[model samples]
Target: LEKAGIEIDRKVLADIASADPTAFKAIADKARAALA
Candidate 1:
């Protein structure tokens, strides 16, 4: 996220993600796809 100028701690992000896996995975997949 820092690469995109967003500042979020990894663990904090993980905790948030764990709270809503379906939503997080969709967005996370898109973000990872961007790297590809």
Candidate 2:
């Protein structure tokens, strides 16, 4: 996950942590696939 362009920086991590898990996972999944 970190290997991709996704940034696990403080802000992004906080947003993801506070966000709905399912929704966040879905978005992350799509983004990872797109990157692939």
Candidate 3:
């Protein structure tokens, strides 16, 4: 998040972390894109 200059809510992150594999992968990809 710091690297991307982005901040996500803790609850949102927790939800993402607990999401299904596909959902988690999508969110992770978005984060990577932000960093890129």
Candidate 4:
């Protein structure tokens, strides 16, 4: 997805985490610390 022209916000990813943490971790692990 990164290779494409796509982007995701930290909070949006965190919201996904609220539902399925594992998926969130996989998607936004790069921004985990900031999101916290």
- Candidate 4 lDDT, tens digit per residue, 1-36? 343322766677678879888877666655554455
| Candidate 1 structure quality by residue, lDDT tens digits, 1-21 | 555444568887788698988
Top model by TM-score, which number? 3
lDDT score, candidate 2, position 13: 63
| Residue lDDT tens for model 2, 5-35 | 6656767766875777776777678668868
Candidate 2, superposed: residue stretches over 4 Å from native: 1-17
- Give residue 19's error in model 1 in angstroms: 0.5
Query: For candidate 3, what is the TM-score?
Result: 0.51
lDDT for residue 31 in candidate 2, whole number 0-100 = 66
Tell me the deviation in Å of residue 2 in model 2: 17
Q: Against the hidden true structure, what lDDT does model 1 obtain? A: 0.70
Q: What is each predicted model's overall lDDT from 0 to 1?
A: 0.70, 0.70, 0.73, 0.63
lDDT of 3 by residue, 1-36 (tens): 656554777688778778766776776787799878
Please provide TM-scores, in order, for all candidate models, with all chains considered together.
0.50, 0.49, 0.51, 0.42
Residue 9, model 1: Cα distance from true site in angstroms: 2.6
* Deviation in Å, model 3, residue 23 alpha carbon: 0.1
